[model samples]
Target: MGAPDYFVILAEMRTGSNFLEESLDAAPGLKCWGEAFNPHFVGAAGRREMAGIDIAARNADPLRLLAAIRERTDGVAGFRLFHDHDPRILEHCLADPRCAKVILRRNPLDSFVSLQIARRTGQWRLGAKGTARMAKIRFEPADFAAYLDMQAAAAAAVTRRLQISGQSAFHIDYDALGDVEILNGLCRFLGARGPITAASSRTRVQNPAPVSQKVENPEEMAAALAELSAQEPFGAGRSRSLEPDRGARVPTYLVAASCPLLFVPLPGGPRARIRGWMEALSPGGAPPLQGMTQKSLRRWRRTNPGHRSFAVLRHPAARAHAVFVERILYPGPHCDMDLRESLRSHHGVPLPEGPPEPNFGLDAHRAAFLAFLAVLRGSLQGQTGLRVPPEWATQSALLQGTAQVLLPDRLLREDMLAQELDAMARPFGRQASVPPARTGAEATLSRIHDPALEEAVRSAYQRDYMMFGFEDWRPEAAG
Candidate 1:
């Protein structure tokens, strides 16, 4: 309550985090340790230990290092946390109200260009006396688009965690990093007695030229920027021309009529079973409420005093296959005919002109699914012309979108749905067994699935696998 016991600068690579750390360290009794949770090294590059905790020890228990930093420091202690750092420590930091959050951001284009230059020049940092290395890098639209998506995802995750926990963070942009007053204010936020007299001069800005001057293919870069600006006018991640942002699908939220329970549904998951379970919770088996807006959702929450919200997650492999079969491989009421055509012609997905023939068997299914996965890899990275439907978008991205309106209190996995749902329902004096697991798609997938398919799915949904810690899909593991 009296200033955070510790602090973390939530940041990403090439976002001036190092400069901010230098500035914070200038204040007396305000210590900003380097990236203590960076998985590649202990604290800083080429270092193995920090505050007596070595790399092996820290990996075994990151909290041991955190404890050391808090206990050994003479004043407020903190570290920088990039988006790709150890997520276990990130979870602990976000959950602890005593951990002050400093959110740092830069323009996605600038950061992307800087990162590319750094990668080419092998110059990540520049000292006052060190000579700066200059390099002109080629900008690839697909690569930049992927970079934007990664940054957006990271920012959304942090924002949602803070919002749900009722915590606030000090946000500073890249251009403000050199302001002495701003640096002093950050020191005050950390409860430091002394003010930062000036911004630290230990580090120098590595790149100071216009983006056009730094990129070799300036004309292509300009064209790409124009296209991106037209597509995402507000900025990266706000909107997309190719895909309807999933956050706008709040109307899909379902609430129970008989009890204070809200179900935030993620498409391509076990929705039918979950909906039936919600209905069964009612005294006379009334249908669950649907078609909720933000205003209506708030009213529902107000009227139901002790409402609990939840969502279920399906394995990426299973989810992707289900979507491919129902929506892509075969025609259905929900299929986008235009998208199917684009996938077949532009993305090299081999699809029949109509529904599959009787001769279409496991081998045919396997080949088509693999080709679809290749397209999925491109579609997710913004290289394809097709829209990314919620049915097949990464679950992590969908959950981020869900956080914009309502973050579920519990996120249960499909494999553990039976027990988890029972436990959740008991607290509200309503108990209903989950309907039997649906195995139609799982049965088909089992026949065509192999290590190759698993690897292909992993390539397409790498973020989901990393975020959820999902293992390879085994038919026996299917619920």
Candidate 2:
């Protein structure tokens, strides 16, 4: 309609969103409120009220504040909405065609590193003095993986909502934040009357150094980033190709520095245990080398002669259940809240509105898992509009994707994982020990194991079953 009644900037932390807000505020007849729906404050940090609505009042009825922002501003009024902000405002804005959406994105690695530095230094913004505090932070692969997952989930949620609603957002990237032409164009999109001659200089770049300089462990950071690039080549908002074929994801390949062992992981398998086993085999129990490219992988092969690459295959039903519990059912960094909501509402999966209650037991979990399996069938076949996550994709398909680059030298079944690993490690004069078995989802699956669940998994992952010769899922048989 008429330039949308107002606008909302859908973004996450450290994405140059604050700079964007400042630029928009500098434009004529355009007003941008800072984090209007941030749970901790009203309009900005340390502020309790906005447009006569206190934090408590805003929490009671967020839409009331939205109305006030629109009514009080003399011209076009808008605000920022982070991924972790109030859900009610997000829901309302996404559905309301009158609310123009502007999405701001940055490299997840940059944002993650920036966020870490910010947390360490407690400097959210910078001035022209450029007298910013600097610190070198260690890069933890596990933490970065979680952060990537969260960013991906947030982007996917907004994207799916816009897609389903048939709405479009004005997308911008962090690098373009300083471009005057792009900022002016954005101002025009927001119905601003005057053109901005220059980008706002109020907020300076806090961390001007390269990522390697800011991180304490450059090698580890490089490895983690390489892994991230291989898994998500295009960052958080990577397009979902419906070709039914995936890339080899070579960067995710793990190799032992001192040993001749390479691990090609199939997501949702016993990756941690495998890593642990591989690490134990390394001299002095060192971590495995990760974040390999095709070129680097070949170099590694040339250097570490006689290296053996291996992959583990878990039963389709067990793998799917693990993915469901970890990535769909539970509320965690790995969980996709949007997908969970869609399953509960659109796919007839009887998931609880929020976290499962203490009373939610085997029966509830079984019913939900069965329903999820039904949806998974469609998802794998491209019938569902959702992207087929690697966590639950058929192992056969994943292996096929891997074969596009390099096939594993050995494929071990989960039931025989420990024995096979021990045998594999024996050549290097080291004995590998498998970690303790997971109990939560495994125990729950065991309690509800039946013919129906097995049938559902078979229907959903016929390729894996046909290729692997897996029988019905037996908890006792699992690794």
Candidate 3:
């Protein structure tokens, strides 16, 4: 193995891989060859921006640059080496049996924006400017296609190495701290004496862009991609850009035999626990309450013959829950709008996004809030007081954001909140297909303030209609 130990950090750069390299280098026994294949200070630790580095020299004979970084210097001390490239590089790099590699992947949006800026500003390493080009360069990579190709190349290479060579490989997620966690995990796994926490989280954060743009000009970007991912296209499951008919595929199915659970990051810990309780709670497509029907809603009192009969026609949490469950279940674009990328927030964890610049309203805010509530509810495992009311679809109610909190057919109950929330991360219940309803109730509790004010309500519905192929959010206007 190269000195320190061979560390092939296959990653999407700009997602903090440089910060990771810097951290790894800070340790006593480690060194990094920034990007093995790229032109410039190939072995210079930390970030390499085209603005300051020379790509032409490295391009002439990248090997010389690689050598300059003390490549294989580790062949002696058996020290660790970190290369932040894709897994595919093994095809070119002569493998020394002493080395080990890890595939570190990150959310695509984080990389895409960085890439866009690199291309536009004229200093990308594999440097493809995302800027509008006056003249096209075949391989210069002027658009999203080029970015995807680079990302794909790295991913494919990593996968290939794993299959062909029995390299000690790992798939890592990126953080502002770079690959610290994964690197440490691998070091521990390999029994290497390396410092995992050499760099602090604060030092890892790069100067963030003043404003992270969610939607660029409509004409240049793909509407479908924009709808699915505001930042990066990582969450997309089996659904593709052109295939509208494949909406059902969006809802995730947690068939343990088919798909393995993911290890998401948690605030308090290094790696979040893996569990599946969403399936248990929403097995059948949402508690089969006598879903809103025109006749039943019109004759409210008659439909209310029993205590189990009256229910809020539309529940915000239900909407949120349905959307959340769909993502956890099949994960497709047609399942629900919240599952779409448009809902992702610019600052925080992926919160739902609303309509573009032209139209912004309180009702839309309400709907968005309710959708968030659903996320909270669906994600809850009795961790809090919130629970899906046993008679949720039919009776009992609470205002969740703008939408009513219609409990699932089963109640989460004040008492079972703990048990239910503990069961939050997994799937629950039987599978049932939810067909579209004919119409909504006639009168919407006149308390909504104004009939026209309902236009804002239409924001949630209209957004759903446009994104998921659903009928509407809750159309109460007319037949």
Candidate 4:
């Protein structure tokens, strides 16, 4: 039998990629390199060594390493690429006609649960000398929502990439990965003889029990999962372009606009907490400003507007990075997914399909961040204008053009959140429980060391830097 050129296992973590890779490797005349772009261990890592080159030298340059591996492999050479792997390699594989693409999908809910369990126990693969720790993992509804959205966006991205590139791919779901026919079909697709026997998988399923047993909040999990299933594709049936309708309800917490007593949740801002506190304080509950207009804003001003307005200023780069993490990187099924979908539809930028794993390097993330910034820049320049979700919009734009447009009587720094809360609370005759904001920005920034991306972020948020006096701020400060 003649060997085919090459193939790519386009998949995500905990999505039965190990099983698929091992099964393919078992086939004669087929060489499967596992995670060739993995930053720490290049060229199949612990499983098989490349002929002679030092992997560490090639690790930094994925393109060189892939070329070296392809040259060295004697058979039909292929490599497994998770969504979070080095994007340069992924793009190269996608663009090359010699490479056959195999897109693997899975039930994201199950995969997410499995990943969570594994993360807690520190047991990612099978046969490792580790016992199952029966600790119940705390369930954050926002986190679960983000994971669901991210998985959906990733799956959609794979389809979109294939369609746009016009690449003929062998699509298989994780549930069908163990099937004999599927395995043999993959071999045939690679131009190899079938009847390939299955190999024992190195990765084990962490959660053997039902989903209910693993999570601390079973009801919440079940509800969230159900809601996720019931939802439509990330941005399906919605307008492809970023056109915020005239009658679109602007989400705001009303206190006053003239005296400027209200707080506007600028995407990724602390508007939610402010709104929640307002509802608790008001006798009628947070006022229904559904049809909020200039008229309504004026009325609010006339009634209670009296030197109560204050705005917290988050660092522009930090806010942009936070938006990328929440909306593009770990988006929920609703708004975050919508923004990602719009980016894909309008700018052809696809969010990574893989969940943010601890071991995955920053190359792919930097690519995503750049893409996200590009879309954001476009949105700002486009007809949609400042009518974007707070995450992508400039802080200056959100505040309606810096101090010149809508100057706050009192401007407080987001880093000094406790003081801001205390000041706001004193006016309402209640002490604020200022919970330290749980932004993962510092941890995320640590992995990023690319000068190009750093400059790109700095340039993209230049307005925020200029207006908010953060021009001197560097990523090192966050780290």
- For residues 302-386, could you state the per-residue lDDT of candidate 2 as single tens digits? 8877778999999988899989999999887989988888888877899998889999888898999999997787565434545
Candidate 2, run of 10 with poorest lDDT = 234-243
Clashes per candidate (backbone, < 3 Å) = 0, 0, 65, 2
How would you order the candidates by TM-score, starting with the best?
1, 2, 4, 3
Which candidate order results from sorting by lDDT in descending order? 1, 2, 4, 3
Model 1 agreement with the true structure over 399-431: per-residue lDDT tens digits: 988888778999998888888998888888888
Per-residue lDDT of 115 in model 4: 82
Question: Between 1 and 3, whose TM-score is larger?
Answer: 1
Q: Please provide TM-scores, in order, for all candidate models, with all chains considered together.
A: 0.53, 0.50, 0.37, 0.44
- lDDT against the true structure, per candidate, is 0.82, 0.82, 0.36, 0.61
In candidate 2, position 211 carries an lDDT of: 64
